[model samples]
Target chain A: MGLHMKRWTVNPETWGAVVSILGFVLLWYILTAVLKLPRFDKLPNPVAVFSAWLSPHPQFGLSIFTRGYYLDILYSVGRVLAAFVLATVLGVGLGLLMGWSRVFFDYSFPLVETLRPIPPIAWIPLAVLVLPTAELGVIFITFIAAFFATVLNTLLGVRSIDEVYFRAASCLGSRPRDVFWNVVVPGALPAIFTGLQVAMGIAWISLVAGEMIAGQRGLGYLIYEDYSNLQFVNIVIGMATLGLLGYGSSALVRMLGRRLMAWEGRRRGGAMA
Target chain B: MSAGGALSIRQVTKVYDPEGVHVVAVDNCSLEVASGEFLVVVGPSGCGKTTLLNVIAGFEELSEGEIRLDEGPLALPGKQVGPGAERIVVFQNGALFPWKTVLENIAYGPVVQRRMAKNEAQRSARELLRQVGLEGIEESYPAELSSGVQRRVEILRALINEPRVVLLDEPFRGLDAVAKSVMHQFLLDMFERTRCTMYFITHDLDEAIFLADRVVVMTTRPARVKLELSIDLPRPRDHRVLGTERFLKLKQAALEAVHEEALKAFQAGERELA
Candidate 1:
C-alpha cells in the first residue's frame, strides 16, 4: 500500500537499501546526465526517465498518466497468468507420477531429460509455426520455462525425503494412498515452493523475450516498438515496469508458500530447501 | 497398554542377492520372545541385528522359515505381509514428522489406521505427553525441539499406538553420554508403564545388559546367535545398579561374548577387502 507513502524516512536499518538504489541512479546520472560520455549521450539519462515515469502527460505519449501503459501491462500479466497456471498443473502432476511410480519414471524421465535443456526462446520459431496465434506462441515460451523448473524441483523434493519415514509410515499401518498423501505430499511441498519461486522468475523473463519476438501487445512489444520508433525513454520505462511486475509476481508466490507451510518457518536451521 | 505379544521366529533366513552379490544377512536364526519380556540382541556392527528386527516388523520377507506373532503368521513360507500397526519400530535416527506438531505426530497412527476420531486421538496424545511432563509443547514442530526431545516425542508417538510389540533398532546410537543415561531412565519408565513386548537391537553391550531381561549375542556375518546371557538385574533398577557386582559380572559375560564376534567380523571384513 505504501511504496508511495514516504520517501525513505522511517527506519535506520533500511537506509542501506535506499542508499544502494540511490547510488545506482546517481552513477547513471553522472554517466549520461552530467558527463555525456561517448555511448552515454545516446541513451536517455535517469533524470529524463524518472520524470517521464511520473508524468501524466509524457512527451512520448506513454507514462503513469497514459491508459496505453496499463493496457500493455494487462496483456503481459494475463499471458503470464494463463501460462503459469497450466505449467504448474502439468509440472506438479508429472513430477508426482515420476517420483512415485517406477514404471512412469523409467518411461518418461529420459524424454524429459532430453527436452529440459532447450532454452525457452529456442522454441519461438517452432511455436509460431505450430501455434495458431503469435500470442499463443509467446505463452508457450513462458510455459516451457516455468514447467521445466517446477517439474525438476518437485522431483528433487520428493527424492530428498528420508527412506525411514516411508518405513515408519507403513509400520504405522498406512496404506499406499495414505502414505502418498500424508508423507510424500507434505514432505515435497517445501521444495515444490522453492521451484515455484524460480519458475516465477523464469516465466517473467521468457514473457518479455517472447513478446519482443512474437507478441504484438505487451510490455515486451512496447519495448520493441519504442526502440523501432526511436523513443528511447519509453523503452527504458517498459523494461523498468517489466522488472517491477516480475518482482511483484515472485513476492506473491513467496507469500502463498509461507501461508501454506507455516510450520516451515519454525525450523532452527532457518532456511527453506 | 499392557497387551504384550509373544514373537516366535523359526529357522529364519534372509539372503540379499542384488546383482548377484550373494550376501546372506541372517542365516537359520531361531528365537522366541516371551510376552512382556525385554529382549535385547547384541552383535558386531553390520552383523544383521537390524535385519532380524526388520523381519519381525514385517518390512522384509523371510527367504526361508516363518515368524509368528501371538499365534498369527507374521512372515510365512510364501506370503509376505507388509508392516502393520501391531508392530511399531523406533528407528535409529528420529522419524517424527517434521511437518506435524508433536501432538499431531503422536496422534497420527490411531487416527489414521485405528479409525479413532481426531479429537479422541488428540486427547490421548495429550495425556501421553502429560505423563512424560512434556505438556506445554504439544503444538511445536519436531525441528524446533532438541534432539533429546525429538527422540522422546518419537517414542511417545510409537507408544501411543499401543502396538503389540515395539522394536528399537540402535535407537540411542547418536546421543551424548549424559543424554544416553537420561534416555535410559526414560525408556525404562515407559517400558514399566506399558509392559509391551520389546525387541531392542544395539551394538552397545553395556546398554544391552542395562535394559534387557535376556541378551543374545550374534556372530559376525550371516549372523546367528552365538551366546544368550540372562541379566539378573532387579526390576525398577537405577544408575546405582551399574556399580553393583552382579551388573559388572553380566557386563563381563556380554563383553567376552561380543569381543570374539567383533574380532571375527574384523577378520572377515579384512579378508573381503584383501
Candidate 2:
C-alpha cells in the first residue's frame, strides 16, 4: 500500500511536465504540417525548422556548427552576465544602506522611487543618446531593468528582519559595520535571491529588446534579422534558442539560491509538523 | 550587594503614547542587584515586568530617574544607553539566529566584539556546549533542535560573552512541563557554576521560587515593587527541593502577591472596557 501511494504521488508531476511538453510540440506540428491553416501554413513546420538548424551551412548564414552562431550566443550571454552582476552588486549595496540608515533612505529613496516606476524600455532613446556607444546603451537598459527589482526587494528584505535580531546583535557588541555584515546581509539574503531570479528574467527581456532595436549581433538580433530576410525557419530556431537560454540562466540563479539558502530550507522543513 | 555586578535602578519610569493614547508602563520602579546574585522578578501579565527588563537592558528609555552600573550612572530619562555586551538579554522565544549553526551563534558575541580570535571563540563555544550538555549539536541549526535545546543554546549564547548581568525575560515560558523542569535544573546548575548576576522576569511563581536567590514581585500596570522575598534555600537545589516545606511557603507567598496584582489589573481592564 505504501509503495503504491509512493508510485502515485512521486511520478505524476514528472509525467505531467513531460506529457505537456510533448503535447505542445505535437499540437504545433498538427497545426502547421497536418491541418495547414492559413497563418500556420505561412510559418515553417517543426521538421523544416529542426532540419535548418541541423544543416552544415544553414539558410540564415549560421548553425550550431558555425562560429557566427556561437558568437551570437556569446554576445547575448556575456551582456546578460555583465549587466546582471553589475545590477546585483550596486542594488544590494544601495539597498542595505537605504534600509539600515534613515538619513541615506531619506536622501535617496525619493529619487529611486521616482525612477523605479519608469520602465527600462522607456529609457532606450535617452540611454542611446546619453551613453557613448550603442553597446553601452543596451547594457545600461539591461542593467536598469534588473537593478530596480533587486534594490527594492533587497531593501524590503533588510527592513523585514525582526527588530529583536538587531537588539540581539547590539547586545552581542556588534559594531555598526559588523551588524551590517552579520545580521543585515544574511537576514536579507533570501529576499535578495528572490530579486536576483526576477532580475535575471528582466535582464534577458531588456537585452533582447535592446538588441532587436540596436545594431550588431545577439540571439535577439538573429531573430529580427531572420524575420526581415523572411527566413522563417531560422526565426523559429532563434526563438527556440532564446527560450532555452532564458530557461538555462534562470535555472543557474535558482541553483545558486538553493545552495546559499540550505539553512533556510532545513529550518522551514523542521518547522512543518 | 556583591562587588563586581552592582546595578542600581533608582525610581525609573517608562511611559508610551500609542496613537496619542497615553499609557504608563513602569512607575517609579527601583531595585538593586549584586554580583553573582540570581534575582528574579515576578508579576502579573501586563504588569510591566518586561518593560522593566527592557529599561534595565537599555532597550527602552526611562521617562524618569537613573540607572547606575558599579555606582557609575549608566543611563537616565530621555537619554538611554544602547544594548552592550556587558548586559545581554535571553528572550523567551529563543531568538537564536535561524541562519547560523549552534556553534556560530554561541561564538558570535566574542568574535563580533573582537575579544577572541575566531578559532579561540570556536574552541570556547565547544567547551560551553559540553558544559551545557549540548556537545554534538554544534553543527546543527537552532530549528533542527528541540525547543528545550534551543533555550539552552540561547542561554549559552548569552553567557559566552560573560556579560556582567544576564537578563532573562521569561526564558522558559513556552516549554512543555518536562522540558521546563529540565531547564530549571540546568539553570540551577549553570548559576552554581558561573555565578553570573542574572535578572530574570517571569509570571510563574513556581519558577521564581525555584531559581531565584531573591524574588521581587511587582504590582499591576504602571508597575512598581509590591513585595520582596529572599529564598534562603540550600545550594545544589534539585527536584527534591520542590516538596520541601520552606519551598512551599515561598511559593505560596509569591502566588498571593502575584494574584492580588493580577486581580487589580483584571478589574482595571474591565473598567476600561465598560
Candidate 3:
C-alpha cells in the first residue's frame, strides 16, 4: 500500500508543466476553431497547421517527409549553429581577458559598453553594406545578438567569482595560465552557461529576422514567402517548425550545460533534498 | 622538513584610508613563530586577527615594518609580496573548488605547482584522504560533503603542498559541536604526522587552548598583541584535555585577555550606535 501511494505521488512540477502546455494548445484551438474569434480569424487552426505539416507537397511545396522541408531546416539550423559557436568563442575569450586584466578591461570596456545596448537588428543595414555577402551579413547580425549577451554575462561571471578563490589559487602557487584555466574558466562556467542559454535564444531570434529580411532558404523565408502567397496554413507550419527548432536547440544547450555543471546540479539537488 | 619554517613579524602595521579617514587594522604587531611551532592568535571580533593573517599570507600590504619568512625578507611596507605556496592558508570557510571533486581539490595544489604529475597527485590525495578518515568520498564535490568533510578536504588541500608554513584563519568556525571536536582531533593528528609550522587564528578560547602550543591574544581594533600564553599540555591531546585543570587554566587566561578587549569593542560599538 505504501509503495502504491509512493508511485502515485507524481511531481507537481512535471504535472503542472504538462497541464499548462495542454491547456495552452486547447485554448488556441478553441479561440480559432470553436469560438471563431475575429482576431484569430486569419490565424490557421491547429488541425489545419498539423495536417499541412504532415501532407506531402503542401502549399509551401514542402512537408515533414519532403527534402525541401529538411533543406529549409538545415539552412536555419546551420546558420544558428555557426553563429552561436563563433559568438561563444569570441565572447568567452574577450570576456575572460577583460575580466582578468584591469588594463584590458579599461581599454575595452568603453567600446563594449557603448556597443552592447544597440540592438542586433539596428546593425542590419550597416552589416549588409559592409559584409561581402548577404549570408555573411545575416550571420553577422545573428552573431552580434548572441555575442553581447555572452560577453557581458561571461564578464559578470568572472567578476562575480569570490575573491577567496583567487587568494586560495595564489596560495596554491597557481601560475597565471593555471589560474585562468583552473579558476577563471570553471568559476565563470555557470554564468557562461546562463549567457549561452540567453545567447541561443537571441541567436534564433536574430537568425529568423535576418532570414526574413535578407535570405531565400530558411524557415523564416518560408513564412515570409507563404504569407505573400496567402498560403496561411504553410505560414503556420513554418511558424510551428521555427518554434520547435528554437526550443530543441535551447534544450540542447541546457542539456549540455547540465552535463558540464554537474557539480552545480548536485549542489542544488542536495539543497532541495 | 621543519628546519627553516620560522616566520618573523617585526612591528607590522596595516592602515586603511577610506576617504582620508585613517583606520589602523593591525598596530605594530610584532611576533615570531619558530620552526615546527603551533601558534594560535585569539582576539575579539573585529580585532583585525584576519588582517594579521592576510599580511602573513602576503595578501595585504603592511603599512609599517616587515615580515620575514625563513630568515628572508618576505614582505615590507608599501611593497607587498603576493601569496606563495610556501605559506598556504586554510580559510575560516573551506574555500574548496565547488567544481572539483574532493580528490581533485586535494590534488589541485600539487598539479598547479607542477610538483607532481596528475596521476601521482591523485594517488597521494587518496592516501591523505584515508589518513584524514575521508576515504570513500574521493569523488564528492565540496557541496556534496558535510561541513566537517569539506573542512577536512580543505586541510588536505593545504597539507598536500607540504608548505613551509600553514596559516589557518578560523579553519573550523561553522561546524556542529561533534564535527568541530572531530576536526580538532583530526588537525592535531595531522600536525603530529607533518610538523608544519602553523599560525592559527581563532576567537574561541577553548579552541585556542586546545590547538595551540602558544596563544597570542590581540586587543580590539587598531589591534595589538595584548598577551601571549604558552600551553604545556601533553602531546597527542584529545577532547579529554578540554576538561583538564591545565587546559582550564590556559583557557581562563586567554578568556580574560580576550574578554577585556571584547568589552572595549562592545563599548566602541555602542558609541558608534549613539
DockQ of each: 0.50, 0.55, 0.63
| Candidate 3 off by > 4 Å | A1-17, A57-60, A271-273, B1-4
Residue-level lDDT for B5 in candidate 2: 72
Ranking by lDDT: 1, 3, 2
Predicted complex 1: DockQ:
0.50
Instruction: Give per-residue lDDT, candidate 2, residue B164.
Output: 82
Q: Comparing 1 and 3 by TM-score, which wins?
A: 3
The deviation in Å at residue B215 for candidate 2 is 1.8
Cα displacement (angstroms), candidate 1, residue A14, comes to 4.2
Among all windows of 10 consecutive residues in model 3 chain A, the one with the lowest summed lDDT is: A1-10
For model 3, residues B56-110, the per-residue Cα lDDT tens digits are 8988888899999888888897777899999999988878999998899999999
Q: Which of candidates 1 and 3 is the stronger one according to DockQ?
A: 3
Per residue, candidate 1 scores C-alpha lDDT tens digits across A65-143 of 9999999999999999999998899998888778888899999899999999999999999999999999899999999
Candidate maximizing DockQ: 3
Candidate 3: tens digits of C-alpha lDDT, residues A1-273 = 555444566689889978987898899899999999998977888887777789876765667978978888999999999999999999999999999999999999999999988888888999999998998988998999899999999999999999999999999999999889888999999999999999999998999889888876898888888778898888777887888888889989999999999999999899421
lDDT of 3: 0.89
Candidate order, DockQ descending: 3, 2, 1
lDDT to native, each model:
0.89, 0.88, 0.89
